[model samples]
Target: MNLFAALPEKERLIAERFDSLIQDIKPLNSKQLAFLPRDIQRLSALLTAERSSLKAGYMNNAVMLSAYTRYFMRWNLFRLTSLFAGMDTTAFDFLKDGDYCLDIGSGPLTVPIALYLARPELRGKKLNWYCMDTSQNALALGENFFLSCAARLQTEEGEPAWRIVRVKGEMGTRIKNKVSFVSCANMFNELYWDTHNPLEKEAKKYAALLLSYTVPQKAVFVVEPGIPRAARFVSLLRSALIRSGMSILAPCPHEGACPMEGKKGGKWCHFILDTESAPKNLQALSEKAGLPKDRAALSFVFASSSPAHQSSSKPAGGKTAGKSAQGASRQHIRICSDPIVLPHGKTGRYACAHWGLTLVTGHRIKDTLSGDLLYADLSAQDIQALPVDRKSGAKIVNV
Candidate 1:
């Protein structure tokens, strides 16, 4: 189910509140509006090609900060919404009354705002939110935006049930209280950005740091841009976390090693969502800024410190132990890529199963998409009959 697709009303409400809050922050005149696009382009370059040139505390600049809030931050919120919508609700089951959530590198409280808008069940919970960031300015603005949005929906005397505590610090900043949920978005890439450190080493270092913020059985959510490097970083982090006894909850159905990792010039782990669902105003602003997006691409990991959930356990591999009258075993497979057209008019899609990378092919393959969980039954004879993909080395299964 597309969770975000079911929340049109909430999406509209968030976009409205965001527009009202941004307007109050900086009411742009005609000339300022014209210059906004240019500012957005400059900021994009700094965050991308010219990122190394970007110094610390760059958000301190009013113009750059404004551009970020209008363009990057808005789009990030949408991306989070799309990501959360795709995930299973069980992933967020750890969050409950009186729970504590620590959001790291929370510039303008984008994660918190996105949570409030996307996950309505979490809104009424008496949760403590510790939003940490290096830029005091962004934190302050984020607080106002969060409160404003919450106030509109909240009716009680105190308004929002979640308490917002802003902490101005960088990554690894300590929190005095124990947290049940830790969320970090668009922040990990900045750390060691210029370094040539091995990806595995970096993943291990950051995984330990992020896990330290949450207690056992709690969860940590990480989001990064869907670029190759970031996606590969997420894959490495998934492995490191699994080795540390953490169980991944979303985007992966099995706990086995990632097959997409270490494959040169091949597909990476990422998902894409169409941008047409975003607010019309935000979309228009993106076009004006010359950065219109047809799709929002992101790579994320949702993991728990506890053991793996039974539903996400490894699939039976060509075993007849659980076979039915059809002489095939049924197991859950996670679709990892869009449908691929093969010779002989066969449709194939990459998936993750207990046996490792698999090519699930059939006429019905086109009906499924990346990030989908499919249950298929295959016999041992069927599995032994096909050749592996030469480029990706995935096992082929025709259903």
Candidate 2:
């Protein structure tokens, strides 16, 4: 079953809303869109150029707006839908209490709409949503899309679905007050590669900015493309935030240093979710643009000011976690990376456990995938050794 199958009705509603949004755009037909063949070529070129410009921290908003309205808007809606659909909402259930959400670089209000649909309890709440963007056109388009969506739906309680406060500016020192949750998706990676600044300097700058913006016990979530560089940037940001007294909520299971950082060949952390269930209009756009729309691959970090939410206390299947070969309870090891196949048909994995970065190897571990809350029956010495076997002993417990 697809991830959203559990919430079939909501999934259908979200797809319908997305389809309505796309249909309203009235994409040109083949005869009328004879110019579209050229437009598509131009859009592809613009996207390529914009990517480089985006990395340099100099986005041409007018070009971006054109690209977005012409093609990427539907694509982004699909991306956001997949991301939000696959997410575990229990981690973000705290937002249902009328808390304020500040979405940095919230292009077209994707995060806000995704967040609302992901949490059923949040539907009728009177909440504050601040969308910070550098483009006035982007903000205007976002507000229009959201209002269009809200117009089609009715709340059972008859409350205004959401109140948006749009802020037009660069990310700076003007941290807003009472911002319960801060979301920055696909924004930090650009800032990380700002051509004028060194990467570490840029990462630290954004880290400090986020630290200053959010108060204690609140959460900040960042999402980026799943490529090695972007994923590594997310890891680096996670380390920076954790070192500054923040606790990681998902993706990482331990407070220890990221293993991928020191790996010489540039392996990084990222997750994948199927996006084949995207709205039909989005699928058509993807096909026309020659883009693979089947998968949503991205890296994200969920960090909170509260340390208690750092690690999972249990694993899948209700099994005892963190047991050692010596019969002692050690820290549970959660598999953080996809299993790496070794020469001897052995599978190796990098996991977050008590000893921080752990390398687990065994034939049985081949079945383990990322996001599995895992526990191994091995001593610290055993884990450090080569080719540890899960057949020797390991457990997967219910989280």
Q: What is the lDDT of residue 66 in candidate 1?
A: 85
What's the TM for model 2? 0.79
lDDT of 1 by residue, 1-399 (tens): 221333458555666467667878666777877899999999999999999789789887788788889889999988887666545555566678988899999989999888887777778889999999989888888888888788776757686998989898998888888799888999989985676888789999998998888777688788889878888888998898888888877667677877766346967877767787787888988899889998887887778876544333333232111124357766567777667878887788887777778888765676665566666565666556556988678887655
What's the lDDT for candidate 2? 0.61
User: What 10-residue stretch in candidate 1 is worst by lDDT?
Assistant: 314-323
Q: For model 1, what is the error of residue 78's alpha carbon versus the real structure, in angstroms, after optimal superposition? A: 1.0
- Give lDDT tens digits, candidate 2, residues 1-399: 112222347445655566456436434345634454345546556445555533322233544454455455555555555545544545565564566778888766778766655555566766788888876667777777676666655554344568888887767726456677888877775555536765556667688887666656588888887777787778778878887888877766566777555233645676655565666666665577566466666777888887655432344352233345674344566555665665676566665564555565654565665545565565655555524335322222212
Q: Count the backbone clashes (under 3 Å) in each candidate.
A: 0, 6
List ranges where model 1 is wrong by over 4 Å: 1-8, 155-157, 308-327, 344-346, 379-387
Error of 1 at 62 (Å): 1.1
Supply the global lDDT for candidate 1.
Answer: 0.77
Give the per-residue Cα lDDT of candidate 2 at 248. Answer: 79
Task: Look at candidate 2 and tell me the lDDT of residue 327.
Answer: 41
Deviation of model 2 at 316, angstroms: 5.1
- Candidate 1 backbone clash number: 0
Worst 10 residues of 2 by lDDT: 390-399
